[model samples]
Target: MNLSIFFEPLPEALFGGDDNPKSVGGYIAPFLHSFPDWRSAEVVLIGLPEYRGTAGASEISFQGPNLIRKELYQLMKGTGPWLVMDLGNLLPGIHLEDTYLRLKEVVEMLVDEGKFPILLGGSHDLTYGQFLGYEHLNKTVSLAIVDSQLDMQENKDAAPDQSHLHRLLLHEPNYLFSFSQLGYQAYLTPTTTLAALEKLHFELFRIGQVRQQLKEMEPVIRQADLLSFDVSAIKHQDAPGQQHANPFGLTGEEACQICWYAGQSDQLSSFGLYGYRPEFDHRALTATTLATMVWYTIEGFYQRLRNLDFQSNNFLRFSVGFHDNPNKMIFYKNRQTDKWWMQVDDLSGQRPPMVVPCSYQDYLTAVDGEVPNRWILTQARI
Candidate 1:
């Protein structure tokens, strides 16, 4: 696919003139006079300036992507011969749905080629398009979303940003294997919506629950094939650039940590950071915070261990037997990363038992002759 036609080059002024050898901009191949060849790049950076999915479109919203780039390019490059390309801002199609289609095509093509796509700046609804990119992969996918509130509005007529989650759950050709939501505030989410997600056997982690045990989030994030982060998930004080920014949410440091976890996941192929509006920003603090998050993600990407082989010498396998149950629980711990995974019997009998990411606590739970909640939920889905 000739993706160049769907994108426009970044403005000359956005580059901020000089590319210091120590800075990230110096390492990145930005689309300017011509589209950079993305085939050789391991990670592709895409700027989505489309905001029509939001309640109202502002001219200033179009500048959000560049503002983030202005801050990101100044940061020092991480450990690498960085294989990164800035694909410039995606050009929105004539209709809102058309824009979604364009994004779906770009993401599908890049990911199909084994390149990681990092989407920067757009309404949170754009995640719908991000999810659609996986439609043709011929396999089910796990999605992890970081947001302060569930976007599952009941109103079918609601704006895409408000109702995208509802649409996603009902999307046809159902390839979504599992859905996990992180950092949702109880006060902001509707009880009915929570009940619906829980009924579907999906995982939901409240902001308070996550903040108390941030490490527990790693397994949830690691299990995802793609992740979508809303700027509104950050506290208003830390990131006031989103229209939905709240006084209470994940701190800037916590947000970066989550991004780092996502980057290290071998299964994760695409990431989207959305809901940033420059018009609402204060001294570009939100942009700086977002840039730092991206920096950590890139660093984590370099640290990937690719420890998927359970039979390898790098993994320690443990089996726990329950006196009350006939099935024995099995677990694998990576010696290098100390990460844990467990096998759950597929009750549906349609396929083989599934191995899913779990935490050290889950292993301990099994040692006590009890089934972990993670195992139960996974089995229920199967």
Candidate 2:
């Protein structure tokens, strides 16, 4: 793949100055060139136009990059201080595993230059590749996944829509830290899969729980090293543009809050917004909402990034939950003082950041013991 020659079309609204953004190897060349000589940038927004990993979403998701870009441009017409470069699409036709490796290479290049990668995804399956890319960053990578379904299918060949996550789990990378599964529903997941995830120490939070105990959800998001959002996590009513639209899920506001939390952390390097189907979206509301979510998430991110009080604490938190009893479980935060530590939570027991305004009752509910609130982190410095 001659990455330097990839041609990507950007929204006309994204144009700035005399130098037009370039198109490089299936990516946006102009966006890549927008940074200060590629050595430093606040964040890089790239679209993964490839949807092959998702059986039902491949064709419809091709419109994802363009749709999100259009919506984002409109939302941030006059926004400031959030330096974002839009690198367009990781196209289809490549092998799944190979695609993962290629995405890894691209992300590694950006990380090497110290640019945070904000991917507008083709599907949630891309997380495997994103994680693989982080393996070489010399930093621990925590995963924050917001989705209604766990995608934890036991059957390897079940529809790609339902199994992208299962494939990711199988290829656990060395730098992979904690995995926080948010917005998952009880019915969408099975008892066996839940048990398996529990044994592995992955964190789980239902949409209902977050709605009930919003404030406590901040720790999980803050503790993540990277964030991955599948729009299906939002309800079908709220965002029906997804291939796998779930009726029981987060509202638009709640979905945005999750992204806001992830954006608050300086240590949270990589971020993505995935799973939008322009065709299924009746009123084009889904694409608009998806775009808005990206902006709000970025807004939340920049708000924290610009704060003078912002501290750089790269902690990875893993939450475990009981299937029958969601409250009966453990909350683990792995803070590496020196070297990059992946899977460190299993070996060491570091404490997570304490909730300042929240009490024990609030923490339990936020952690799956109770229902979630509309607003999760109200006392955030940003």
Candidate 3:
């Protein structure tokens, strides 16, 4: 795709002078002297320095990508064959939409080549670009977003960072199959917005709900093809670098755990971490936090398992029959990973019955002669 023309090489000085052979910087093939051979890499890192999507277009935000790189490079490397590449900073285009187009092209190329793309960003609005990458993939997509507030602002004239979710949800061609929002603080989210998502049969996890049942989020994340995490989802104390840092949100550790879950998902193809502002950072604490999240995600990626084969002996199957409905619900639990899945009849009748990721709780719910909410939602969508 001739990607070199769209990116600028990382500054030599940003490459930490850490001499330790085990450091991540020593292992990654950075685009310093020349473009790294991304074709041979399993994970590719792209730095987005475009802040025009937000108000005022702050130039200070341009340094955000490198700030994260500085902390990331100093960390110790994870388990073997670290085929990672730093593609350096992506140069913003003349217009904000133009920048989005550039990002869409890069992501489409990388995903088409079977490589994971992790976008380190200047603003959350770039997720619109990330979503656009899947437009030509010829398949439906499930998207998971983690943020303090739903970005689906009603004002059409609002900045893209605030209104991008609206664009994503209403995007033409209707390729989005599912959308889930995690770690949203109720106080920050309006009831109207919540009701709107409910009408669409989408899933949402309030911040309190997420903290109370963190493990339950795994299946929701596992269902996603793309994930966009806004740093505002983290408490201001843990990530003070965000422009709109909230006092209450996910902890740094919780954020990393979510990233780990996303990384391990067999369906997830691209991830974007956004809303980092280096100018507001405190002693680089937020930078370190984001870097560690990236590290955990990469580690989880290496631990990823291939698609499950239902007929195999590695899974245990269970059947729960309904008395009144005369339909039986079938469930499968992975012996190796302990993940659960349930079979649901496609109400649309256009395709075969779909097997979707579920939680242990859902299986238990079905055993009690009740249909789980997950099953209801999946059917409603169909």
Model 3 misplaced regions, further than 4 Å: none
User: On TM-score, who's better, 2 or 3?
Assistant: 3
Tell me the deviation in Å of residue 313 in model 3. 2.0
Give a tens-digit lDDT track for model 2, residues 1-382: 3444333645445433233222111122235333223343466777787677777543564767777776566553324366665665564435767777778887777766767778887777787777777776675566788887788776767766578677667764555555778878888888788888766666788878888877667767766777888888888898988886678788888877777777666667788777777778887888877777777766666656332221345534334454666343322232442111111121122544332212334335545644323113221211
The per-residue C-alpha lDDT of model 2 at residue 20 equals 21
lDDT of 1 at 1: 76
Query: What is every candidate's alpha-carbon RMSD to the true fold?
Result: 1.2, 9.1, 1.2
* lDDT per residue as tens, model 1, 325-381: 887899999998899999998877788988999999999999999889999999887
TM per candidate comes to 0.98, 0.73, 0.97
Alpha-carbon local distance difference test for all models: 0.91, 0.63, 0.92
Give each model's clash number: 0, 18, 0
Question: Scored by Cα lDDT, where does model 2 land?
Answer: 0.63
